[model samples]
Target: MYKNIKVIAFDADDTLWVNETYFREAEHQFAKLLAKYETENKIDQELFRKEIENLAYYGYGVKGFILSMIECALELSNYKINPKTIEAILNIGKKMLNEPIELLDGIEEVLSSLQDRFKLIVATKGDLLDQERKLEKSNLLNYFHHIEVMSDKKEKDYKKLIKHLDIHPSEFLMIGNSLKSDVLPLIEIGASAIHIPFHTTWAHEEISEEASNNFKYHTVANIKDVLRLF
Candidate 1:
């Protein structure tokens, strides 16, 4: 079914491997820090909701996430947490830079299989350095002919990517975890999109529904299963 697609762009992070799990763990630590000032459940719930709101304003990236964490820390602690406490939380986020690299199951094999017929691309958004490092460490970098590390994934970004690739939207396919950031924008530009839900999703990425027929929103259980389509 995917044989006719010329360019298949994949989202990194949760779509490629484990990412939301790391963020969830970090948020748990932040909740612990708030225990003295507020109930853990209240703190966690508020932070989770606020994080989603922050994403709408700042979008996704390490810097925005750090800011959200700072905001949550301050609010949950009733504004008593000092700069040092904030800095410590920020440091915890920075340490994610060195997190171990591991690809989703069958990612390697599927990339290998698709390489023969499709032009593979990695289209991910985040802090440039961290995203680049994760790609490099995964050893999956070699498979993609192009890499798009963006601060945001708006429709314009998709247009630019298509223009740069010199391919029409109909010939391109975007595979990702987030309907907000990945699928919707690309589909609006007439490209096909595939949605593969990660086990643990970022608060900002939760979508109301998958795309309807107008966008060709295919669904998959996991990244590895993409091979079956090809």
Candidate 2:
């Protein structure tokens, strides 16, 4: 249904490569460490629910994410923290920091197919170092003609990205996982968006309605399925 599209902006984390799955695995390991102090009943759903709600306040990035984990560790430990346990938790974060990058299946083929038809840009928000490292390691960096890494994906960043690329809103499409960060803001700017939800923890941004005709929206189960749009 989409046509006349000149540029397509892709979210880097969950949209292009595997992100939340690694975080989920780390969370499970973190919980096992926390288990020594707090009961399963006390810290199960409540903690995760709070974290999801707090994402708006904290935002997403490794620094804030690691800080939240440290806070959780301190709270659960009742201040009686073990050095080794703290070390282990820090190690998990470190591992994530330097983790090997793996692109989601079919990402290369899809991008290659669309490269000649659309101007592909990597539009993501996070710590610059981490995001750059991930892109470099993933080897998918060269596919995107441009990269826009912002502190946040609000109107300001979207406007700047489009302006910098010299592309009009009608000619740009955003593909991402976070509705709040990627889809909604771009839609507000009169751009098209596609939502590719990952099977992992709750993202603060969730879509509540179907997309309107002026703005196209497509929701897919995974990254590989996103290729159908092009």
Per-candidate Cα RMSD to the true structure, in Å, reads: 2.4, 3.0
Cα lDDT of model 2 by residue, 1-230, tens digit: 46878998899998788887777777777788888777755655545665655567666666567667777777778888888888998888898887778787778988988888888999998778889989998888778898888878998889988898887888988888887787878889888888877666344555455643445578888666767766
Candidate 1's residue-wise lDDT over 177-202, tens digit each?
88788788877888888888778777
lDDT of 1: 0.81
Please report, in order, the local distance difference test score of every candidate based on alpha carbons.
0.81, 0.78
- Leading candidate by TM-score: 1
How many backbone collisions does model 1 have? Answer: 0
What lDDT is obtained when candidate 2 is compared to the true structure? 0.78
**Relative to the unseen true structure, what is the C-alpha lDDT of residue 173 in candidate 2, on a scale of 0 to 100?**
89
Cα miss at 122, model 2 (Å)?
A: 0.4
Error of 2 at 198 (Å): 1.6
Candidate 2 clash figure, as a count: 0
Can you tell me which runs of candidate 1 are displaced by over 4 Å? Answer: 1-3, 48-59, 82-84, 210-215
